[model samples]
Target: MRIFDPHIHMTSRTTDDYAAMAAHGVRALVEPAFWLGQPRTSVGSFVDYFDSLVGWEPFRASQFGIRHHCTIALNPKEANDPRCREVLDILPRYLAKDGVVAVGEVGYDSMTPEEDDVFAAQLELAERFELPVLVHTPHRDKAKGTTRTLEVVRESGLDPSMVVVDHLNELTVGEVADSGCWRGFSIYPDTKMDPDRMVAILTEYGTERVLVNSAADWGKSDPLRTYATGQAMLAAGFSADDVDQVLWRNPVAFYGQSGRLELEGADADEGATFEGNSILRGARAS
Candidate 1:
């Protein structure tokens, strides 16, 4: 089953993870700018991280034949920090890059006033750029947070269809479904929705606007969780087309709204490198 992980942090993963994802049919994925394991100290740190998201990460994914794209934003967790707030100033620069497909991982972390402000600002950025939003709903008080999320999106006047309410479960999916926003489920090892539950959701929801991702990050997670969900769907009697719709086509439809989603096709210069740095040990970009 071909897969497209709509939200994953490939920077925290290894080359072997890319190889495994490619082998499992992940032809493309979006790596959103999120909070790393530790708190970053300054805007400069965010700049470097965003740079790697667009620069090094794409080159890394291409080595394994997976097209890499990213979303640029000041993630909600770091939005609480005054120092990190300056990262917002530089977001558009990264957002304008060809690799950036959305403005994301943007939503309430603590449901704080600061998170609200930052989230609103990023929505403005999404509006200005005409990009889709990959919103990260709060892990705690999700019912309340998701309610507020929809409220804020409606208040911002951003089309709900342009927003993806991610990290959803059975309790939250219905609300997002009714809100006209797309649904996203993060299949993780634990502490998030499981593949069986994801399949159950698809069965009930009928796969219209669902997006399933591994959300593999620095935490204990599995980048192959998306592929595993497809397998589970098949085991549950979901057709291959059903698996493709949830895992691949749905994501393509969402991010493709940016008009910047480019799955790497035949390369005229297969040996291309990032600047002068090569993923190949002995080959040159020429």
Candidate 2:
């Protein structure tokens, strides 16, 4: 089951996770900009993080033969911080770069007034850049968060087809489905949707505009959940074509709207370096 994980956080993962994901048939992924486990104190902190997303992380993923792409945004969780607000200003520079497939992880976190303002600003940036968006619904009060999310998307006047409302469940998927936007589910190990539940969702929704991801981050998340979901689909009698649609084709179709997705197989040149640095630890002996 070839896979393209539409959302994940490799910044917080290890190289072992990359090797495991590649072995499990994960060929490509998109790592959205999101809050670190702790608060980021300055705009410079975000600058470093975003640079790694566009630079170091892709190099790391390539070592394991996984094509890595990313989204650029001031995530909603940090929108309330006056210090981090400057991140929005610097986003345009990153948005113009290669490997930035969308403007993402942008939506309500606390649903605060500050979040509303930042979310709207990023959505406008998406319009200006003509890029796809990855909207992250609130983990708390998700149904209400998703409702307001779709409303904001409508108000932005960006084509709903260019937006993906992520972290949805059975309760919220239907509304996004009807909104003409793509639907995204993050399959987790213990919380949120799991493989079986995702299978059931696919069974009902028919896999047309669905994007399944692990969304694995610096928490108790599993990086291999995308692969697990594909296995579950097969166990539940989904055809190889059906699994491919959800795991590969759907993500390519959604993020492909950016006209920037580089789906080429990962070719790791061990001698290749980013900024005069390599993932290698010691010199090789002949």
Candidate 3:
């Protein structure tokens, strides 16, 4: 089953994870810009981080035969900080860079007024850039957050088709589905929707613009959940084409709006060295 993980944090993941993803049929992914576990102190730090997302992460994923793309944004959690607000100014420059397929992970973290301001600005950025958005709904009070999120998106006047409201669950999926925006579910080991639950959603929703992702990051998340979700769907008697629509086609249709989604995911040359240093187990250092 070919997979395209539409939301994940490869910045916090390792090459071994990339290798495993490729081996398990993950052909492409989008790593949305997000807050680090700790606070970022300055705009320059986000600059450096965005550089790595479009630079180093893509290179690393290529070594393992997976296509890598990313979204650029200030991220919601840090938008409340006065210091990191300067990141909003620098986002356009990175958004123009190749492999930045969307402007994302850019919705309510705490639902502060400040977060609201930044989220609105980034929605405009998505409009200006003609890119799809990956919105992060607040984990707490998610139902309320989701309602407000739909309001914000509707007010932005960006086509709802170009926005993907992510991290949804049974409680919130109905509203997101009804909103004309794409629906996203994060399959996690715990604390989020699991594969079985995802299958249940498919059984209920019937998969039009629904998407599933692992959303694996530095936390205790599994990078293979997208693959596992596909597996569970098959076990639940969903056909291969149905699985294809949810796990692969939906993401392609969403991110493909960028007109920059060059899907050479399985076409990477297999080499295991970076910066003239060998990464292979027994290669002589040259």
Using lDDT as the measure, which candidate wins? 2
- What local lDDT does model 3 show for residue 73? 92
Which consecutive 10 residues in model 2 have the weakest lDDT in total?
Answer: 277-286
List pairs with backbone clashes in candidate 3: none
Q: Which regions of candidate 1 are displaced past 4 Å? A: 264-286
Task: Report the C-alpha lDDT of model 2 over 116-198, residue by residue, as the tens digit.
Answer: 99999999999999999999999999999999999999999999999999999999999999999999999998999999999
lDDT of model number 3: 0.87
What would the TM-score be for candidate 3 when compared with the true structure? 0.92
**Model 3, residue 132: what's the lDDT?**
89
Instruction: Report lDDT (Cα) of residue 180, candidate 1.
Output: 96
lDDT of 2: 0.89
- Candidate 1 vs candidate 3, lDDT winner: 1
lDDT of each: 0.88, 0.89, 0.87
Model 2 regions more than 4 Å off: 266-286
